[model samples]
Target chain A: MYKYDTYDQAMVDARVAEFRDQVHRRLDGSLPEDKFRPLRLMNGLYLQLHAYMLRVAVPYGTLSSAQMRVLGDIADKYDRGYGHFTTRQNIQYNWIKLEDAPDILADLAKVEMHAIQTSGNCIRNISSDQYAGAAADELVDPRPYAELLRQWSSFHPEFSYLPRKFKIAVIASATDRAAMRLHDIGIEIVKNDKGEIGAAFYVGGGMGRTPMIAPCINAFVPLDQLVTYSEACLRVYNRYGRRDNKYKARIKILVHELGKKEYTRQVEAEFAHLLTQGIEPPLAELERIKAQFADPAFESGLTDSVDRSDPDFALWVDRNTAAHRVPGYAIVTISLKPVGGIPGDASADQIRLMADLAKEYAFDELRVTHAQNIVLAHVKKADLHALWTRLDEAGLSTANLDTIGDIIACPGLDYCSLANARSIPVAQKISERFAGREGELGEIKLKISGCINACGHHHAGHIGILGVDRKGVENYQLLLGGSEGADTSLGQITGPGFDEDGIVGAIETATGVYLANKEGEERFLDTYRRIGMAPFKEAIYG
Target chain B: MVEAQIRFRDDEPVGDPAVTADSFGDQTNASAVRIEPGDDARALLPHLDRIRLVEVNFPGFGDGRGYSAARILREAGYAGELRAVGDVAVDQLNALRRCGFDAFAPEVPMNPADAERAFATWPDVYQPTTDGRAPIWKLRHG
Candidate 1:
């Protein structure tokens, strides 16, 4: 983790004080509601359907065990004893009070965490692959550049009030675990033919009412010019992006309307001008940030063997553990999705327990996956059994990672002010229906969002369910063939929408079709893409 | 008494003698000109030497085109007074100043005592902007 210096601490402290004053002004009737709304939103306070919601940024999805404990403390002290980890690798407290928001921010600032730019039409929290540093196939640990971007975008004057919200994702691995292509700006750190590390820029890709897979604007930008090039991209969008209609205000609309070649040309023009101005940070800054992400000391002679005598522990080890770059180490995922329970909701006690487990078994660092699960990225193989037992006791040891049971869902109409129908109940129902069929489903990604704003990333799910409102009734539309991996593609909606029960049955029928038609060892997405959505649609609608 | 209105030129409040866009062409002798949110700032870049103040109107705080306008003027070497007029608040003061707005003419006057604290809130910033403040990166490397 990047340690905050005196300057960084001072900036955050100032922001907290500024927000506290704004809150006081709003309360004293000195500031009217219309003006106070934007101020509160910029600080991550939202007027939800029930209470004020605060979304705190977990930068690049990395958190210290101490930071996780603080989150648990916040949930217990302020919220309703729980917090929902979102698809954006953030945590939202649903029962926040308007008056206590500044205090919450102050607490987060103490631990070098914040809720800045978590909302509003600014550069949002920069997200990256949760397995960034520990994964075996990573080209580079992307957290350093992510931290740099986080700093650059924070309180940016030019891009702060963009036409619409801007999200950026960075990933170094070939597999896009962070849904990089679905972001407004996606960066893949790659090595050029000359062995120099650079960035591949993807612009205008997003998921919302208008879903787009960002096209490559620049194949390779030198490491030195990454910030300059990104600034150029945003500058073009800030000036030319449509603001007449809120729905069409995202950068995707501008790219779509201007055509990729023209948009790229404009960005290049801006990049040239910015380069002349010498806006790129000095090389020493990059080295300074990189030093913070150095690998922790590892025990070299440890055995790589895990005792698989216990069948339950073996199942979990196979399902929830991933290969690590370091020998005799593994990345362990703590599944938040228990069968018949809400996805991504961790109780205060569960959070504290996970925090303690990270400190004990892992290297005191944790990651929050975009799938809304916690990851212990540097766990030793020998500690698997003990960790599994502790996790099982805490009800966090569900051997259902990437299975039908591990569903990705958004807080839909149940809690969201913009949702048209309920999503959590739908996700719960679907997970319950597929409880014992994890093996049969075979690596299915099922995502559910309550509305067109695809917060659950339903557009990237192998079997996507979107809840819609039709004449005062709840309905769901099924989509097939969406994948957020290296081979990114949006799911195509099947036929008509179904009632809540009908949708659950539809998912079952679709899974049955996959089981019957799949080739040997093929994942659900592979099968869907190979056979197309026709069979699944026929099985569901027929 | 006249209505309380906040106005500034070069971070200091001069009289509210800024001319609106509708009257800007006629007031050729005016040193400061106020442009609406929809007006293009590029048009005034060529006249940078004569104009000492460029006031950009923000009809609503959410309408952020003015921020871009201020940046454009500054990048084009308009070192004159860059004042953000209309719908401005203390929350937006730091950003406006960063985007090269040295003054503010908020639609509603802010309490001067509170506004001073807001402007000096973040003495150091992480990214370099038109405000010319040395970013933390520069300070660290140097």
Candidate 2:
């Protein structure tokens, strides 16, 4: 994990004081709500339905054990003793007081954390593959570049207010674990024929009322010009992107409207102009950042096997653990979605327990996955059983990763002011309905969002459900065949909308179709893609 | 009724009436131009020699296209008094200043002390824009 230097510390400290004054003005009524909304939102404070929601950025999903403990402490001190991890690898506390916001920010500053750029129309918290450093199949770690961009975009004078919110994702593997294509700007670190490492840029992808898979604007940019290229991409969008309508304001719409070639030409021109201005940070800065991500010490001559004596333990090992770069180690994903519970909510105790486990079992580190799960990235295979026991005792051990039970849902009508329906209940019912049978079902990414904002990432799920208001009652429209991985595709709606209970039943019926028609080892996504939406639609509709 | 202006340039801000981008080319004597949210700042490049002041209008602080407009003119070698006009908030002062905005005239007048504090908010910055200030990275690794 990256530690904050003096410069980094100073930046966050300044932001806290700045926001503190803003909050003061707002409370004193010097700044009206309409005027203060963007200022508050930039610091990740949102006025939810019942209360204020403060989103804290967990940059590139990386966290130290100490940082995790502080987050838990903040939840206990300022919020309602719980925090909801979001789809963007950030955490949100639903009950934040306006007066306490400055204090909360000051506390986060102590740990090199703050809510800066978590919301509002600015370059948001940069996301990357959760298993960046520890993954077995990565060309290089992507977090250093992510950090560099994090600095570059922090309080950026020009991009402070974009036409709309912008998102950027980075990945180093061919396997798109970070949903590279479905971002405003997606950078894939790739090697050329000559074996030189560079970045392939993808601009204009997002999933909202309009879902677009970003197109490749530049095939390969030199490693040193990464920031410059990104500046170019953003400059074009800021200059020409539509602002008349909020809905069509994302960079994706501009890219879609302008066509790829024209957009690329404009970016290249900007890149050329910026190159002369010396906008790119020196190579020294990136190297300094990369050194912080050096691999953790791995003990030599260790066993690679975990005892499968208990079927439950074996099931957990099969589902939650991923292969590590070092032998005899595993990347353990602690599932937050307990059956019949909120998708991403972890109590303060559970959060502290996970932090302790990271310090004890892993390498004093944890990561928040885009799927709203916590990962102990370097857990030794030998420590699996003991770790599992502790987590199980704490009710943190859920053996459902990417299964139907491991549903990703938003804080819907229960919390969000933008929500049209309640997503927590939908996720709970679906998770409960397929609790024991998920093993047979194989892999199914069930995602639900309460509204078209897609904060729940419904469009990227294997079985997506979007809640809408019909007249006055809540109705869910089911969609299928969506995947956020390398083969990224938006889920398509399957005919008519269903009532709350009917949607869950509809999902059951659709999965039944998959089971009956599935080949030997095809996942729900694979089966859905091969067979198309006909069978699922016929089953779901009828 | 609030005409308070904060100027950073050594030269006095020209008081000439500003013309729109469409009429800037037509008015041979026009020394100042006003850019709206949608107008391109590059349109004044050819007439930079005579142009003494450029005002970038930000009708709302949330619409940040003015920041880009200011930078484009500055980067294009327009060395005039770049005044950022309209709905400017105190919190936006540092960013506005860093984007090569040497002067400001908020539609709603700001507290001068707060404005000065906002100007000095960041001890350093992360990127080298048209502002001519060395970014923190350069200072660290120069």
Candidate 3:
């Protein structure tokens, strides 16, 4: 975790006082609504359909247990006893009073957190693979670079107020767990023939009203030139992105309209200017940042010898575990998707317990997966049973990781002002319907976004459900084969929109088509690829 | 009414103040305040004028009508007190400075120290936008 130095501290302290004054002005009718709107928005306070909503950045979904506890306290004190985690890895408080927002930001800053640039048409919270440092498969941990980018993009003068919000995600592995391909800018750390680590850049990929699979702009941008290349990409978008219609404002639209070749040409032109100015990052700086991400000391002389016969332990190990690069350790996922419960909402007490577990059984670190679940990376295999029992007691031990019940849902009409339908109930219904399958529906991605903004990133799911209001009635449009990865593809709508019950039935039919055609242990996404959507399309429309 | 402050003309300005904006210069009772817009900014060059301030304007919130003008003034080496004026508020002050405004004349009254304090809340910042100060990351690691 990056701590603020004197300059960093000064900036935050100044920003808080500035916002505090702004709040006072607004309350006193000095700064009119028209004048105060942008000010509030820049601070991550929004006047949504209901009361004001405050979004706090959970940078790369990394939270200290202490930070999580503070967030819990904020929710309890300033809002309803719940806060919603967003697809962008932010948390939103739905019922914030216009007056209390400054206090909330003050609280967050005490723990080195603030919502600045979390909203507004500025660089948003930079995200990366949750398991960056701890992932066994990673060639290099991407956090130090993410932290550098976070520092650079925070309060940047030139790129603030872009055409629309800009997002960037980085991952170190070939397997894109961070969904890098579906971001405005995706940087995957790769090695060269000389074995020097660098970034493979993808531009214009996003899931919003317009869905785009990012195209490779730079095959391998040297680590030294990462900042320069990034600046070039932003310059291209800031210079050319459309400002006429807000809906058509994202850089993806610009990239789509200009065509990939033309966009690349523009970025190359801009990047050349930086090279001419000799503005690339110093090699030493890159080395220094990389050094901060060094792997933690792993325990040697350990082996996986936990008893597997206990049904509870077996079920947990089987469902909620992932392969680690380490021999004696495993990546343990604590599912927030308890059967018939809200998908990603966890009680504050549960947060503290998980934090304690991370400190004890696992390394004193936790990662919030893009799947809206938490991962206790590097948990020694032997400690799995005790961790499972404690987790079971806390009600966090749901053995449905990546199953149909592990649904990712947005705070639809229930919380978000942008949503047309209530996604929570819909997600609940789908999870309950597939609850009986327990073992059959293995490792499927089911995501629901309440509106076209796709905050839930439904377009990236293996089975995507989008809720819309059709003539004042809530209707869901189901799409299949969408993925957020290096091999990213947008899910295509299978058939007509379905009503509340009808959408669940449609998913049931689609899964049935998969079960009939699958060739043993094939994940839903793999099955969709092996047997094309043609079969599922037929099954659903029939 | 206290003093007949002689505002610096484009031709009579001195070395830059290291920061300056139109709003600040316009509102200041300081005689050294310099006001220049359009091509007239170049004329301020030869005077070595004792000008220590400049004022920029925001025509409208959505319209970034004044940002380029402020940057151009900053580029011309007229580093003085940079201020933003007209339709500006506390929200725009941070970005206003990042784009080169050192001070702002909000439509409403405000304490300068409190305004200065507001800029400190966000330690991490992106974008190369700033009035004249180096970014925090650069300052720390530099």
List the candidate numbers ranked by lDDT, top first: 2, 1, 3
Binned by DockQ into CAPRI classes (incorrect, acceptable, medium, high), candidate 2 is high
Better by DockQ, candidate 3 or 1: 1
Where model 3 places Cα greater than 4 Å from the true spot, the runs are A275-283, B1-59, B63-87, B101-132
Q: Tens-digit lDDT track for model 3 on A453-494? A: 998788989999999999999999999998886678889888
The list of candidate 2 runs beyond 4 A from truth reads B1-4
Off by over 4 Å in 1: B1-32
lDDT of 2 by residue, A1-542 (tens): 79988988999999999999989999998989998999889999999999999999999999998889999999999998999998899999999999999999999999899999999999999999999999999999989989999999999999989999999999999988998999999999999999988899999999989999999988899889999999999999999999999999999999999999999999999999999888999888899889999988889888898899999999999999999989899999999989898988999999999999999999899999999999999999999999999999999889999899999999999999999999999999998999899789999998999999998888999999999999999999999989999999999999989999999999989889999999989998999989999888777765
Task: Tell me each candidate's TM-score.
Answer: 0.96, 0.99, 0.87
Q: How much lDDT does candidate 1 score?
A: 0.88
Which residue pairs does candidate 2 place in steric collision?
none
Q: Please tell me which model should have the higher lDDT, number 1 or number 2.
A: 2
- The DockQ score of candidate 2 comes to 0.89
Least accurate stretch of 10 residues (summed lDDT) in model 2 chain B?
Answer: B1-10
Residue A24, candidate 2: C-alpha displacement in angstroms: 1.0
